[model samples]
Target: MHVLLTGASGVVGRFVLKRLLDDGCRVTILGRRPVEGFETGFCAYDLADLDPQLPPADALVHCALVHAPGKFRGGEGDDPEQFTRLNVDGTRRLFEAACKAGCRAIVFLSSRAVYGDHRRGETFSEADVPTPDTLYGDVKLAGEQALEGLCGPGLNGIVLRATGVYGVSPGLADHKWSGLFKEFAAGVPIEPRKATEVHGEDLAAAVALVLKKTGVLGAPFQVYNVSDLLLDRQELLALYATEAGLSFDGPAASAATPGEMMTDRLRALGWVPGGRDRLKTFVHSLARRGGAGT
Candidate 1:
């Protein structure tokens, strides 16, 4: 299959790009900059200007997001209007362009943030209504709605409401927990933090699954939850510290409300994510890579 992938230079997008390539699919990246050492193809366009016709593609995996550097939850920075214009409107335009350009499948990478923090300590499923509290969640929800409205009849749309993604990416100096690990290495008193996280490789695998089973996706618009481990900073640091032979202090556990999502829908369709084993391997890799910033 010929796949057109966006945000190919991003931390998460890099994983999807690599996974698509590994699956023997022809990929053309649509981004602002050329991906180093990548020989497939590259197309340039501003996120605010996704008005051009795309190259021929069988699938469009949209991972591109316009946000402030080093953030996604508060990515709007100080420009919420611009954020809405870029993310919400930008997403709608991109999907329409892809469908018009003859792409059969459009996979949107939505966020678990769309569910908000109000459901403290709650588990979410596709059946649960999304109650977005922040602008970020609202934008993502709006983007999913746009896909639902525009995709049908010869176009397959799938939304993967992903949780926090972790893992090393190509051409990046830092992983998601670089700060946390650095703090631990420096003996900075850590605060207890917890959330749902998935390895980048496993998240990529979820995307690949839906791409292959586009026909069996049932509805014209399908939504699936993608997540793996319920990680707590206290436990994660303990694991890392053990592997690094360092001492981690503070961050006493509390009655923190845990957030979880149901991936049974994706699992039933043969999508299996790397579980606790992968989490351990990831920590081990971090320890091996000097533990400070790897």
Candidate 2:
């Protein structure tokens, strides 16, 4: 299969690109800069001003976005107009162009932000109506809706409403937990927080599954909540601290209720995450890289 992947240089997109290449698929990357050591064809352009012309492919994985540095939730800054222009409008243009380019399937990297900040004890499912609380979430939801409107006869679309994605990536050092790592290493007191998370590799696996399944194409639009763990930040940080040989007293229990994101729909298609074991490995790698002082 030939795949056109945007954001090929991003933290998550790079992993997806690796997965696609490992699966023996031809890939064409669309991004602002050329990926180092990548021999695949590349198109350098900003998503805000995307060119309609694109190489033909069997499927497209859209993951490009302009977000605030170091933050995913409500990180659009004060410029709502530019945010809409880049994320919402640019995504619409990209989806339509992919369809016109004869692509049969598209996978959008949406976010759990579309569900807003869920109340404690609330588990989100695919059936929950989107109640975005920020412009970032609102735009992501808008992009999904736009893609659904564009799908037709032979075209199919899948929206993966992913949770916080974390893992090591070459040339990408600032992950969702970068700050926590620094704080834990310095023995700074950390506040307690809780949320769901999924590894980048697992997210890529979910996307690959959707792309390979022909039955999904029969539906005009499908949405799935993709997440692996409901984690407490204090405990997670303590795991890192232990691996780093640092002393951690841990934070008080968080008053905020925790929530789970159900992935039965994606799991039905044979998607299994790396789970906490992978998380442990990730933390170990971080500790090894940063050393005991980190």
Candidate 3:
């Protein structure tokens, strides 16, 4: 299968790119600049100006988004208008172009923020209607709808509303929790926090499962929540502190209840995640790497 992947330079996209290649798919990366060592083919097309003239592929994973550096929820910065234009509008255009180019399956990487202001501790699922609070959530939800609008006879779209993604790749140096680990190692007082997280590998697996069953996937548009563990920061950081020979208990467990995003829909597709065990393995690996910050 020929696959076109956007945002291949990003952590999540890297996970997807490596998995697609390992699965024996000929994957081309599309972006402003081609990602080194990862691109089987490179299509440098502006998201704001998508062209159907780009090479065709059996599947396209739309993971690219226009956002402020080092952020996502409030990634618009000082330009919310441009943010919508690029992320939401650009995504819709990309969906159309892929559909016109006869791409059988397109998986859109949406966010868990789409379920804004839900009751505390609610187990959010695909069935719940999105109530985005911030512009970022609104934009991601809009992108999902855009893909949904384009699903039909020749197109099967999948929207994976993912939660906090955590992983590391070779030569990447740092990851999402690297800074937190640094703070903990340096004896900085750690705070208690908890959130749902999924390994990027697992999220990519979900994408692959949806793309694999394209023609026979029954539904033209499907939304799946992709997340694994409901982890507490104290417990997570404690692992690093323990391994690094740093004596610290961190803060008390957070009283704030963390919500869970149900992945049962994706699980029904035979998607299995690396749960708590995976989380421990990742932390341990980082700690063994001469301290996580390094």
Candidate 4:
């Protein structure tokens, strides 16, 4: 399959790109700058531009967005209109361009933020309706709605509401837990916070599954939550401390929340995440990389 991928240089997008390439799919990347080794078939354009002359492809995996730095939740200090134009409007334009380019299937990388802040013990499934509380969530939900509206007889759309994605990327040190690692390494006290997370490789696997499942494309639209682990920052810090041979006496364990972003829908499709084992490996790797030193 020939795939057109946006944000191929991003953390998650890079994983998806590698997975697609390993699966023997021809890929064309659309991005503002050429990826270091993938310049041969690159389209240089910003998502806000709404370029019409997109290259033809059999499918499209859209992972591009304008997110605030280290503050995706209501951190977009840009003009509201511009944010909408770049994300919501930009998504619609891209989908239309994909349709015009004869693409039959599209997979959008949405976010778990659409579920809003879950009350303690609250869990979410694909069956739950979105109640976005932040501008970022609002924009993502809008993009999903756009996909729903655009799906027709010949088009198939899938939205993966992904949770916090964590993994090591070359030359990229500021992953989701980078700050926590640095703080721990510096012996700074850390607070406890709970959240759901998924590995980038697992997310890419979900995308690959959706792309290979032709039957899913026959449906008008589909939405699935992609998450693996429900973790507390304290527990993770303890694990890191053990691996790094450091002392970390942080806050006590917080009450567990029952309401987590569930991945049953994707699991039903035979998708299994890497779970905490991957998390352990990742932490150990980070420790060895001097995340524990200074």
- Top lDDT: which candidate number? 1
**What is the C-alpha lDDT profile of model 2 across 147-171, one tens digit per residue?**
9898778888999999888887655
Candidate 1 wrong stretches, greater than 4 Å: none
lDDT of each: 0.87, 0.83, 0.83, 0.84
Estimate, for each residue in 156-243, the C-alpha lDDT of model 4 and write its tens digit: 8999999888886533556777777777677777776777889999999999999998455447699989999988888888998898
Tell me, by TM-score, which candidate is best.
Answer: 1
Give every collision pair in model 1. none
Question: After best superposition, candidate 3 residue 37: deviation in angstroms?
Answer: 2.0
Which digits, one per residue and each the tens of the lDDT, describe model 3 over residues 1-294? 998888888889888888888888999888888777764788887778855456878888989888899999889999999999988778888888777666889999998899984556888978988887888889999998888888888788888899999988534777898888877777778778888889989988887888887777678998889999888888887777776777876877788876688887788879999998898888777767778845
Q: For residues 144-182, what per-residue lDDT tens digits would candidate 1 score against the true structure? A: 999999766898899999999998886677898898888
- Root-mean-square deviation of every model: 1.2, 1.9, 1.4, 2.0
Displacement of residue 223 (Cα, Å) in model 3 is: 0.6
